[model samples]
Target: MNSKKLKILLSLFTLNSLSLYLYFSSHPDHRRLPSRSYSVSEYSPPHHPLSVKPWPILPSYLPWSQNSEPPFRSCEAYFGNGFTRRVDPLKPNAESHRKISPSAGGGGWFRCFYSETLRSSICEGGRIRMVPERIEMSRGGEKLESVIGREEDDELPNFRDGAFEIEVGDRSRVGKKLVDEEFLDKYLEEGTIDRHTMRGLIGSIRSVDATEFVCSEWIEEPTLLVTRFEYANLFHTVTDWYSTYVASRVTGLPIRPHVVFVDGHCQTPLEETWTALFSSLTYAKNFSSPVCFRHAILVPLGYETPLFKGLSETIDCYGASAQELWQKPDNKKTARLSEFGEMIRAAFGFPVDRHHIPKPASGHNILFVRREDYLAHPRHGGKVQTRLSNEPEVFDSIKSWASNHPNCKLNVVNGLFAHMPMKEQIRAIQDAAVIVGAHGAGLTHIVSATPKTVILEIISIEYRRPHFELIARWKGLEYHAIHLRGSYADPPVVIDKLSAILRNLGC
Candidate 1:
């Protein structure tokens, strides 16, 4: 099996066990264990928890943007960075791993950018600036709508709170109007292409800090916030933490990050989780009313952050009871890829959701045949030793099934393509009307299928799997199983039974 996929499984298992570790850290289960190698890196808890006080100063307040006609500062306020990698840092001199979208005629305008490379934001903001447009309220609305990136918009993560605010002031506070009509044609308004533009417009940038109040300045009073002392170790937020979001219109807190993932309340600093969080923010669905900032905070027991009240989708998964959290039943585990898939989905912005089809594309019917789908060979990665199609009956059966129906088309995409780039594979599968595959990694692609796609999962009797069935159910696709006797060497047959199953099922 691919180590990366296995790593995801290990991550889930580790999360399930974290509640136990919380217990182990306390008096009832006090015990010390030697350190071991971790997937990312070896880590050992500090002899004492490290202090997180004043956030570190960002590299620079502002920098010169490339090809700029005027001076501007970066709006990132210092988050996002590159993780350790092998790629040459300076290669393709201007190569940026993120896709950014900019707002026009800026005055408190939101500029959007989506990071394409994980952890590649280390040099962020350095290269881009979130300057506002010189706006004169082109159209009137009760609230301002700003898109931070190129795709789908949603309620800020845990943004289960707040109201929109309107700002009407001298548009001059934003940068130059650069009203050249030709500039607008440069950036794309649709599908993300490789085309690159150095524009930095995201959440409305504060022209002058503490000077305005409408998503621009802090209210005179501190926003009332709910917080906790305990939280997940990974989410540990700073003590005396101070932050702010746009003021709430309902209860009227300065700003609240609408909450999501409220499950890990042990504060992971907002800056530390910004990339992952922002990706989710772009993926969040329609908000109710009062869409606003959503943030998460974490803290240690008996410690408190400053009256720092920042709006966030503050997930407070702290102090969860161990019994309710750590006691997980085996086999109940969701797909190992599900979490990463969530991140990717969020990263994908709304393109996937907006493309949701009530039915699979009707253009072509494709069945991907694989040798190990029926069973995961005990070997590592379940390497298939033979051609599944050449086996007397697998292809013949598929051929016969195709011959029986004129409307139903059948095409073959190899199993080798299963682990290929998902973007390309998914694009191909998107065009396939019917997808037939075995219970293997390729089946994971079902997550990208068009609705109404028929999926036939071939299973091994000795190792019947409910995993594919599980995904099919969640994906809302038509799915059924073909059980085969692993020990029976009937030339790996696919008989008329396959036809009966497909013809009877709705796709």
Candidate 2:
């Protein structure tokens, strides 16, 4: 009894399953799902839509477009491997319209298309209107009127005082009209300009005769005397050089043409380095010869880039005309030379502007800069001048760190910079990824280093300055500084701290 019922149920289930399958097969979504797939080679081009106009690429060559180069190759390259072929605009039944109106179908069409070199939208050729007016025609007026559907009655109205007669006239005069009494009176009444003036007790003339082209009295360009009167520090000297911008601003010159009259007292040997630094500004050949001036501006050390508070106050002593450039809200703190930096880079061509120059085949290098030659601190004593008491220990730590990282190479560079040429210095800095040194003027070499390079400054508690910090920030380098406690000749080194920083920076 159970076997017979089970067979009947199975037969009903099979028929129901067959009916459901047939229904789904005929559904529109289901039919579209497994639509015929074709390879790029097998696919055929469809007809162009009525909206787009066909621009044929024919044998008779003509300057069809403003640009001479075709963009098909670029477009094909932009679409990587397995991209569908471009739809032909000239083909009567091209499938270009499928990509034209994204709203109509799938919307991810590469929208740029060029015909003969003229870029045009796939959907843009429909009912384009420029203007609705009667354009002028040089040919027969009657023919143009007929084409424009305008009758003789529709001609523009010609206005006249008496008879409807007016002729197109030619020019009667070449120059400006004569300024007679009436014209002069009209202008005088309007207060536009006052050409007539009384000289002392003499009365104003009615109308003065105009003269031929003549030169007016020349107004002298403002001159600035930038004596080497600034502080003798290297940072101060660099900062003072940038302060020349203030002189430029006061003179109203475009960075050039201003004379940097460096008096011998505070002058450094500007022959090599100063020339490159001040290349954007003009410098006087010799400061010994003084030029006579009816009116001249004197700029002092503390005027623009004052290291201390007393500098700006000194500029005020020169009377009301002297203004401090750094004090202004527009001028950033200190003498930040964005314009000068660009000029220097362009002139000397330091700081190579490459994103990825390969590392030297010798090793992954980290520079340990030596400051034994030049002392950045203003302290006079030789004992105070020498920083990093345990140089050998610090050097060994760096070497040990390098040894741990087999690829890294530690290079100790000190008096080498003073000896090497500027180009060689640039080359050395450009290749190094990380620079380590005591807080000193030697760290300024980071300026020539490639961007994104790391700067590790070993600082002394007694002498802390943001000179190199500011320079590092200006040069777009990663700066990390660690302070050591001591006032001795060489500051004590924290070996563990140094090791951690080196490891964190990937040595």
Candidate 3:
């Protein structure tokens, strides 16, 4: 009787086991065990849902920190290999300290410290000393110039006919000693000073004694030290902003650092734009007494740093060459320039990564950047030289063409950047499918354009330059040009070029 009962139970158990296996295999979602209490010895944590997530995580790729930011490690780890160069405190002026050793991915040289305190001592005419550290005055109270033995080259050379001639003669000896013909040619054409000149401007690094200067106010957050030009031209400002971004990336700050403009220049119209990119923005002049930063990064000038070069040049800033600074090593498909463009768009709170997305049925946006008379600064009257003799006529013709185009619907945008707020201007540029403009600073907005955007720059014979052309190439955007015989571009010729570009883009 016991043998027969055991046999029946064994057969039932085998059949039940087979049926459960089949059910679980077919309904895999139900395979997970139901919630239940377990003994301490038997308990095992479930795997994280995100553990099997796919590649190319968006938030991880962002240069700036987000919620649950990564922990702050050593400067070497944060800045990547070979990006941070330690300055020998004893021999700060040694030859090795003059240049940062090169590394892959080409991020510009930067010095980061867990804590750094700088004293801003006011000089004559309310200009704060621009040196990295405070200088010890001789017992006789000698001026900085007498102590350093060379006058600072803080002022950019004016390239006007008379000023240019005077500058060449004035710097003739320096040019002969520190630079070659090609360097001098670039200096003359682009107003770019060499490394030696930049070094001279910054002066020698003196003793860093926090006790020497009193701190009236202290900035507790991480801060970045940036030197900028006095004027607010869009091109120069872009270089400064880009350099700041590179500094943020290389330093590996978990959060965006507060930016301190170390220059003595008064506030300009563009200062508002600078304020938006960081946690805070302050000028050297703003500190009535010496202010100290808890954690500081002294960012080198983009002009002198190899990570990006040719800052003063009318052509694109050496951004295209500094792929290491912008492009993540793992992602080779997106251009480094485009990464920077995305950074700027994100900083300005504009929609990002929308360049390659399919367009709506209505059609593409053709943005025509218009240059008009406006007061850029206090010194000059509100009068801009006419680059396009008949700009209004050309704009009208383009508008007409966009409306009549049969291939696809076209939306022509009159990009009157001067009248628009900075955010609105960026929005217009980022949203455009094509940007058209005469040779002007307003055209610099193309740096923030979407990847798929096309650029059509009209160069008058009088103002021929490669600024926008080089930018388009670096950004991997399609670019075209219309060469005008004079300051005037024929409307029909521009329309033809626009039509051809749209045709190629399958408009």
Candidate 4:
């Protein structure tokens, strides 16, 4: 029966082929028509299985299933200390991001799916634990030139070692400085880098890449990086410190700049916590993005500074200092961190979340704050006092030359100090030949000063904040002591100390 059916089909095919060939031959004039070769196209289409599998539609009855998509997103559930559902990163699912365990410095169970420009944070799961019981002790006896070589430029003697200057096994073993200080639980003590130190360090660097490239394996440096960056944090945000830097290209300053907080600060916008978070002194290190810019960091924790240099922006008027009169006493009372972040953003003309990493340029000055410095100068003394009261006296205690020294020149233009950008304030302070200040937030700005900058650390003759002296020495600054008779609130804090320090610098 099969052979008979095959013979019938063959007979039919033969008749059809003969008829078609005859018809084509009869129409030979069609050769003038374009060659009718079928233009072949190849593609992949969804494959349907010949057989069906059992359906678990019963899951639809789940209480959470009411809003589940028809074709639910695929998640790979990998259970470890906790369940980590690896959502497809390409789809922007919350589960696809990197998981940051409290062990790795997360507040609780927060996960940052991507490793972006992590310029700010030092250690994650930041608890104010006793300082590390052990650290590769600094071979303090070895001079800077002896350890890393004195010649920082090209043509160094140890060029053959490798691109990195640190010699093999050079991290001479040293005992970690045991942490002896204690603080209340209210301070976000878990994270590293005291806010005071960070302010100085962050203020020291003059520019943050509005954009930066995200990197995971570039472990020798920031979690993210871009050429010529300043004041970048984990949120992939930047602060252009030099007034000339942003305006060197664009004519004016920006009203809104892209930003992110890399430190272990809680990520919350002022709008989200208008009543609760802001009302209470939660922590100085919190972060948030309101408007003008959304974050590409995708999540709050994923946001970092020094973003990839794939984008660009006109620095324009955004580089100028804010004219909202924040230095005034009443203004200081309203100076919220979110607002501070907002003021600089607008001054630099960048969306709080919009960053374009710029292509690197030559002859750029680079400023780096050692990890040692970052851990010392916290804004709050592990107390809820990080938020300072804006008062004339508070400003008076700092006794900064910002108002007195209208025209100072460190590099190029004169009168630079008078019109510097928010980021430039630290740089200008650093450029000063002599530095002076009582024990307060303004001292944090001193970390940016050029080496050889003399420091006049004013503290009580009876009481002392030892970190200042240690930091001054570690940073290679010329250290001087000013022993005051009382707390920093006293008049001698400024009147007696400021003038002497300034005269020494030839101010």
Best by TM-score: 3
Instruction: Kindly list the per-residue Cα lDDT of model 3 for residues 347-388, writing each as its tens digit.
Output: 777666473488767688999999988766434456887889
How far off is residue 94 in model 3, in Å?
23
Answer with 1 or 3, whichever has the higher TM-score: 3
The lDDT, on a scale of 0 to 1, for candidate 3 is 0.51
Error of 3 at 242 (Å): 0.9
Report the candidate with higher TM-score, 3 versus 4: 3
Q: Number of clashing pairs, model 2?
A: 8
Q: What lDDT, from 0 to 1, does candidate 4 have?
A: 0.25
Candidate 3, clashing residue pairs? Answer: 105-324
Error of 3 at 390 (Å): 0.9
Best by lDDT: 3
Q: List where candidate 2 sits over 4 angstroms from the true fold.
A: 1-224, 230-232, 245-259, 266-271, 279-303, 306-342, 355-364, 373-384, 396-404, 409-412, 415-431, 445-449, 473-476, 487-507
Residue-level lDDT for 95 in candidate 4 = 27
Candidate 3, residue 190: the lDDT equals 26
- TM-score of predicted structure 3: 0.61
Error of 3 at 392 (Å): 0.6
lDDT for each residue of candidate 1 in 54-90, tens digit (9 for 90 to 100): 1111111111111221111111111111111222111
Q: Which stretches of model 1 miss by more than 4 angstroms? A: 1-363, 369-393, 396-405, 487-495, 501-507
* Candidate 2 weakest ten by summed lDDT: 123-132
* lDDT at position 394, candidate 3: 96
Candidate 1, 491: how far from true, in Å?
A: 8.1
Q: Every model's Cα RMSD, please?
A: 23.4, 31.5, 20.1, 29.3
